[model samples]
Target: MEHANTAQLGRGPVTSSDLRRRQNGRLASIGEPLPIGMRGADAGGREGRSEAPLPLILRRVHPLILLSTVLMCLATGARAQQSSTATYSVTFQGNWTTASTPGGVVGGAHFTTLIGAVHNDQVTFWESGGTATAGVERVAELGSTGTFKSEINANSNAISVIEQSVSGGGTGSATFNVTVTSDHPRVTLLSMIGPSPDWFVGVSGRSLLNTQGNWQSPIQVDLFPYDAGTEDGTEFSLSNPATSPQGVITSIRGTGKFSNVRMARLTFTLQSAIPPPTPPPPPPGGGGFGGGGGAPRTSAPSAPRNLTAVGGDGEVVLTWEPPLRDGGADITDYEYRVDR
Candidate 1:
């Protein structure tokens, strides 16, 4: 006699046992479905039963449902492989004093408002052999960042703009923070040397990522003077004739008044990193054939490890390692309140 739930196909009713046998045979041919009742039985197997009801459950699962589950898992794996974000404290230490460059350091020597952006290889704000844009020209020649700031904001490839300056005489320092991601890891910064024609100091397209695809910290770069090639003046004076046709950007070191000494230096120190967001939990009640509750909830990451602080003349630097347990999700960010 045919069971009430036995499915009919073609000439006769197909019993659950017969369906199971056919499914198992097909799976076993592909190196799946260990003998029934064994651990790690293939997807078609059911444990602790001579002939189980899983065959009915499998029959009820639509092909589309199976495809959706597979796609979700693939997406989750891709999210887990995303890159982390990094924040750095950039310090610009100016050394363009009369003592350092006795050849032509002027009395009112100072640095204009520093302006630049963090971007990728797709766009370049300024480079050694490249011609300066209208924005770069204004920043280098007139110490104005209005045009440059607008230019940076207009570029889709640019990530963030940096604007800071040092006061007092030439030997001052300015510090600011900037964030970077794996996609846009390069930094370009420029600041004009005041009382000059079109001489500026900066780094162009400097990358912070290392060979292992991680942020490198505490990197220091010497800043040299570069001529915007827009003016023909060689001395520290503002009244100079413009280069009639304009020329390509070039280093001013060992040429005329400027010497080979570094005008300033920039230090990039890692502050914190925000890892990619955790893949969303699997949908409620697992998508598998037999519905069950979703996976257990995850907890927040543990506190950062071995945090240490070092005090400087007017600043304090803090560093720490990632938590031992990430709580099954990448850390998004770290927040700390200062008591002082």
Candidate 2:
């Protein structure tokens, strides 16, 4: 015997009346409000009481569930508010030549390996009018970077270190890429002016972000020679003794021996940027039952499909199909490694 409010599936062609009765019965079973004219009555014209409405359903939701949902939304918004990372190609363009320094040029005059860090305002790697650390002294006097690198690594505020050197001349350029976030937007770079007692050229605590909190591109800074204040040598290639008491770092420009000319220039050009993610929208109706926001969280893309490799003469050819899912953002690159 068929029930008074049963949905007939895979039995004959079901009528519209059958579907309406099935829907009403399901809603009533779950304590959901019935449609107009269907209240207080069953499909077979039997009298029955209707279920409570949406407000009652909301009241049944646990307090903890609502609190958890609110916390999740707040966390999502915090992640979205984080600033993006910006990468730049920092180029050290050395102009150390007889023409620039005039009477102070010496043979084999070259810049040592460049070393620097991208840090925050809380730390200043090396600054004018400040006494040089052991790392700074070595870099300015002997063109060594070991101590400086260690110093940078130990500092919690330093984010990245850049190290590269020009090849074979006083007048050359070397470029390396560096990345910086809003929290550590300042840059400090230094290189020794070789054959000098304690001379170096650099910029200290220069910020890459502008006042409007945007990354600045193609920044050009004129470099001047500064005395490390550890040695008392007045001319390049002179064997001078260290100062009795360490002095403050001071600019050597227009100080008798050095001419008022820039020894080098630094140019930072933007390479790429990864902007922060956008937050999900808030729940509808200020949150509660049937409130409609909160989309699914995205993650790394699925593995590639149909990967294949063919061996050749001293080489290999590989190919594969794109992943079935790309999470939420577009895939920008792929990295591969080979193990032998």
Candidate 3:
């Protein structure tokens, strides 16, 4: 045992042999953890061998063992944080009846489990103008997963990771594994349904407030089908792109058709000590960009108030004071998306 002047202390000559002997004594303690770096001088002569050549003798770990240990930890972390910034293979397991095309729901099913993927700020769900990437399009059109992996790689941000899975609608559950960067740990399961095009099961920025490592069980999320707005409307591969015509604005865009897929408002909140997003002050007024856009629509900026995620009913409600940018429209609508 060694003691120092309220600073650092360590045992003598902690060589590999010493570490191995200590580890052999206990099953739980196997690998050599990065030891505390300290020297006798810093400790004010904590040990009698203050003048030893290698004062701080951390047991040199065997290269293979060290690599294995690091890999094991990385894998554990990947699974622990399956939700956050990685790709999770989502499989549609439940009864899917919604029309994958623009047609209405044909059967009793209301878009059950549709395989989907999630990431931070950037999204895998479809968006306006852009067609569903080949992966998403294939999933929507043919129930195939072959190309989705490539598309996910092409569409992800440097911080994103991908995990995926799918299953045929039969007797058992279609299982999939969630893959992601070993860091971001707040995301959860992503789902998708087939009846609709560009529609899907999306679980965006989730909260890891309580969960750290192991799961507590599964929670039922809305799995709202976001109209990636990709491919106009969700369409299937036709002998011609005309036969399955998928780009009709029905419920999702509500722009062309005005139906307002109105699947219910979904809100995802990413809470972290994130650096406050710097919003460029309205472009220089006076005709250059923000200049000619009128008097910059005088309004109050939106002050973040309270954000609530109501369980069971499945709704994320955010309430805030009117924005400084309010143009007096009574704040008709508010849009919320994951902020990475």
RMSD in Å for all candidates: 18.3, 19.8, 24.9
Candidate 3 lDDT over 104-146, as tens digits, reads 4433223333333434444534443445555656654445555
The per-candidate count of clashes, in order, stands at: 0, 0, 35
Q: For model 2, how does the per-residue alpha-carbon lDDT over 174-282 read when each residue is reduced to its tens digit?
A: 9888899987899999999988999999999999999998999999999999999999977786478999798989998867556777899999999998876565565
Report the number of the highest-lDDT candidate.
Answer: 2
Candidate 1 residue-wise lDDT, 105-153, digit = tens = 6888899888999888798899999998889888888899999999999
Best by TM-score, which number?
2
Worst 10 residues of 1 by lDDT: 70-79
Error of 2 at 163 (Å): 0.7
Evaluate all candidate structures by whole-model CA lDDT and list the values in order: 0.64, 0.65, 0.33
Cα-lDDT of candidate 3: 0.33
Lowest summed lDDT over 10 consecutive residues: which window, candidate 2? 70-79
